[model samples]
Target: MIRGEWQNPALTRCDSKLAFRSLNQAAIQAERASSRTGELIIAYTCFDCGAFHIGHADLSQQLAHTVSVEPGCRECNLPIPEAKKRRARACSAKAIYCSDRCQKVAERKRRAQRQMASVTPQ
Candidate 1:
């Protein structure tokens, strides 16, 4: 979650569609109760828990704030394939995987290497 004054423990987690619907409903109620009705919200997946969270910021703006870096597959050391570049752009600044498959393969390899290292200690 982006750190700010808006962090709340009560924020419910939901999928993108449901979250937008709920945000709309809440915004409607808030608008009805208040004089302003320009309330805008966006849903983003929380990096901490892998859950969706809603925030009062534009998606493009939030994405713009992210500093994109050249990414490579940790397991293969291959520069992100051309096909995956677009997908990589949408990922978080710290994203490690060019794709889900790469992530899983890297994780499995890491675990195996760790086990081998542990069994062959100097």
Candidate 2:
């Protein structure tokens, strides 16, 4: 199934391939393409434009080397799953937190700390 909408060739560098500005957008298209085509589709970052693109998961071997060591969440120190690790590799972004709740808590703590620092008298 066709995954994404067509764009000007100048923008994508190719008339056939579709480019997504974010991993989340590419991932959503990948899911739809996977479901329709019955293939393991995945979102990957393009080396040329740094935009995300969709392709077969098996093609990942040509992209980049997978991380050997498992990483833990920064906020809770919990181990991240292998699936998440794969997704992180595709996007070139590390998974800092295991869940959204942990990320939110970390953000709140940072905000509070900033507020406290700003309000304190010298």
Candidate 3:
């Protein structure tokens, strides 16, 4: 989740959404985690206004947490194709994604029935 969007766990993780430095940090972290294969970092950018939001998610299982990540695109806070990852990179400075597929597919489901999507800060 982006800054101010997180409330649970005291929201220890929150960073800028459109900072270049942030994007680089995310790329490096993802590169190391995925063995250089590259991880998904979804970035939210507005089409009409070009405004964006950075989403935070962990692809590596090593960094496991008790928190539950509901299925959906981390950026834009909307449900999209699994192949369409968020534009945001993941890093202390900013955010990024492993692949376009992983980023986009987030929160996306193939099931006929769908569950309501919400980003509740518990």
TM-score of each prediction: 0.29, 0.38, 0.18
Candidate 2: tens digits of C-alpha lDDT, residues 30-98? 999989998778888877666788988765653443457666898888988778777878999987788
Q: What is the C-alpha local distance difference test score of candidate 1? A: 0.59
lDDT tens string, model 1, 4-34? 6775443433333233234455555444543
Candidate 3 matches the true fold with a TM-score of 0.18
The better candidate by TM-score, 1 or 3, is 1
lDDT of 3 at 70: 53
lDDT of candidates 1 onward, in order: 0.59, 0.81, 0.43
Q: How much lDDT does candidate 2 score?
A: 0.81
The order by descending TM-score is 2, 1, 3
Model 1, stretches more than 4 Å misplaced? 1-69, 77-93, 120-122
Q: Pick the candidate with the highest TM-score.
A: 2
Quote the lDDT for 57 in model 3: 48
Candidate 3, 6-99: lDDT as tens digits: 4443223233334324545545554565554444444433343344434444565335524676555444554554433333422222233344
Model 3: residues with Cα > 4 Å off, grouped in runs: 1-20, 36-122
Looking at model 1, residue 112 earns an lDDT score of 97
Off by over 4 Å in 2: 1-71
